[model samples]
Target: MPQTTVNLRSLFLLSPDVIFLNHGSFGACPREVFTEYQRWQLELEINPVEFLGRRSGELLLYARTALGKFLGARPQDLVFISNSTAGVNAIAKSLKLKPGDEVLSTDHEYGACDNTWELVCREQGATYVKAAIPLPFDSVSFCDRVWQKVTPRTRLIFFSHITSATAVPFPAQELCARARAARILTMVDGAHAPGLIDLDLEKLGADFYVGNCHKWLMAPKGSAFLYARESAQPLAQGLVTSWGYSERTALNADQEAYAGRETFERRHQWQGTRDIAAFLAVPAALEFRRKYGWERMRAECRTLAALTQERILAANGLAPVVSGDDILQMLAIPVPRAGAERLQKWLFNERRIEVPVTAFGDMAFVRISVQAYTTQAELDALVSALAEFYKDKGNS
Candidate 1:
């Protein structure tokens, strides 16, 4: 698309009045994909019995196959989940975390995921330790820093492929290799990865991974997936109760990773029935991305994001959260004053610029996420709003 045709206003379903700069929190569905999603919903509503009865299985298979191809995963190994939290919850809850077994994860994990691990570990008599990766993170040194936390009791290493608050891409390939060598379970939270990062599930080499399609993949809300390595599938279980399960009568494929051992039917696939349209729309999202040249499109998005990061930080006298290479599509920088939340509120109320100003650790910061539909002008709008917010400081 031409630069002008890449109008931020037209490409997304965002409100005409709001300048949306938070594509990272929850993805902004493109107008075309949103239309397709609505169409699928309408089709399902027209004949709930017929659509979900005879054709639901087939429809799910088609979407799964298409999404698996997009992620370079086998359809059978991937299961649809509402989001990454639920996906990881299914894995974490099913794991047999005996006493003295430690689940080492980074401090940068999303709050909800941290709670998920805490809840699961508390019940299973396991320890969940936060491995602090010093800020201004150097990816080459990240593995060693995290490795120092590991001990003979360390049974699993969990971390994010892209940190939600920090927006740093942790070097997982080397770390997963080390964990595999030690026979330690390796799982990752990849919620922000798929479309933002070049993903080859086989290459990531984690025992299990889950990410959101609604975030970077631009799918409708509630569309995401969990990918478990074939060897690790036995530990899998559904987080909800459902009829998809075979009772005590196990399927031909059964093992000890916990899928059969836990309530996979009741927990995961049988989340009781809601809108299947969002999931059914995943293939359309994948196809739209594929046909639209997603790879180059992602690269362009990174370029725009980098430009925004540079322009804003330079104007605000702040530093880049991490080097351009280490971060993905989002950048997190410390806010100039106390109460980043107040600044977030001020920015929105005064400027109509919908951006994120979140507090992480001791520092208050703004996390900026850039998407393909975004333009330099929108980024400039954000900069102007922030600079104006602190206009008396004369930084801009």
Candidate 2:
């Protein structure tokens, strides 16, 4: 499959001393996208009130509209947030849970998000159940495993579109549909999904969906979105409620006030007046992806990612957690759990290799993030570092 060549390295403003292979954690922005982001920032500084207060509403509406159409969603259903964390927080805050009400999810969720649900459940008297889905999962089997956690008390099914540590793409549409049939609210944390995987938020059928534009979309940091289905929109009370409340009594009218999604839009949209430039940079990112024909680029990156996993694991000192066929843009290669921190530290402190050594349960993995700019030479260097580390330790 022939596609245009992309220099993934040229996109980042990172220093030359760093060999960044951790696109999965926080994505590297393209030079062009950064240019657009800075332009918006400058415009904001030029007239903060005019840019943020006066014109921002309409500008954001347009951005949301463009983003919604791209995601196969409605403008009203999508709103901007700092990141997927904030988006999920908005949903968690809005939900009213009883003492025994259960929120079912898998164990592979991001640590912070797990905390978010845990704390929220504690306060609301709801039970948060983490489904124990085993590794090396097929979609059907994974769904079956997670479904076992659902009971009569299960009010919500919180799932991830793509997991963080494992880098596995969950069968979210299947789970969302099943939850829909059961009349259970489903909130999907699509933190790594938007550009890395194909997205159709409307068709995904989750009651609440949140994604970050920064990851894989090449948008500036703090660009993210919260999408709520028309039905679930009522559950949102902004993480910090500023406006979208009754000016007079501060009482939310169940009868007179909009029992719908107005609360989510009004409250969450204006969260104590922060920088709006990042939000405005979203359109630029989208446009950049469109111009680059990101579908082709994504396929190419996945291929490179699979190859990197294969070559690295095939080496004597390297092993892998997941197979190449299942890998997306990121692959987790197993190394000595004891030496994991040392290897990572040595590579960064000595070799200037900017990669992440992630610890999962009892496993230590050298997680490499493959993007359009990743090259064979860099991959070779990473492999060499591992080989050298093992040889020096007399482990191989």
Candidate 3:
């Protein structure tokens, strides 16, 4: 495979000593986007009363409008949250689960979100079902495996759009359509899908979708969004109740006068006046990506990811979790042993390479994320480091 010659690392503020291949963990912000984030913070700090009291709502609306447009969603149906975990928590806590009700999901979900659902289900006397999705996944087999786990007691279906541990993209649109036909609500944790893929929320047909702008979108930290369909909006409640809740109730009482009110965005927008500068900087992040031709960059990154996957598989004589077509910007290859922690520490300490070695049950996977700032040489360095590690472990 030919190497990608374009190098955009200088645009980011990453350290010169380390090769960053872990953009999927927490995205690195570009210099331009970081400047815009600081600008919003400075504006807010200059006059707290004027910014938060007078102009915050309008500024948030503008940011939401830009973000909704990018995600192919209505601005009224979207609300900015601190992160995707908060969005997941809001939906999980708001649902009224019965003693026998079950929420179905796969085994590849993020750990924090799994904890959130488990806690909510335990409190409500409900069951959280984790279906086993085996290796070498395909769209037909994957969808069938997930659907077979659904039962009469299943009230909702929850899964990740792009899985965290395995970095595989699920067939969410098909699953959402099937769930809707069966009268089961669908919630997708699209934490890594926003900038990695072209998103269209309405067409995708998920009832509720949560995404992180801080991951693949190259936005500042604490920037994420929750999008609910018009019908699903009534079921969503804010984690931290504040003025938005009271105002929503007041509007509900005067429904005749406040008809067509923005219920979803209004009810979740304000939460006790914290720092919203990150939320306000979403538009600048979007603009920065557009100005640099993000679509082409994403395609190039996928090529790099494919090359890296091939190199890793060849080096270790290991199989991939799924085929190359199943992945986009990130790829995961299974390692020989179960000691992911030791491998992660050794890689970071010895090679100065920043990447994730994730443990999935008894198995371990080295997940590589290729971003616009990632180059061919960096991936080569990672390949060389892994070879050295394998030789030391007597696996070569």
TM-score leader: 3
| Model 2 agreement with the true structure over 51-91: per-residue lDDT tens digits | 76567667778888888887889988888999999888888
Residue-pair clashes, model 3: 0
Compose the digit string of candidate 3's lDDT tens values, residues 213-259. 99889999999999999999999998987655542443222232333
Q: How does each model score on TM-score?
A: 0.90, 0.91, 0.94
Total residue pair clashes for candidate 1: 17
**What does the lDDT read for residue 355 in candidate 3?**
88
Number of backbone collisions per candidate: 17, 1, 0
Candidates 1 and 2 compared: the better one by TM-score is 2
How many Å off is the CA of 193 in candidate 1? 0.9
TM-score (C-alpha, index-matched) for candidate 2: 0.91
Least accurate 10 contiguous residues by lDDT in model 3: 250-259
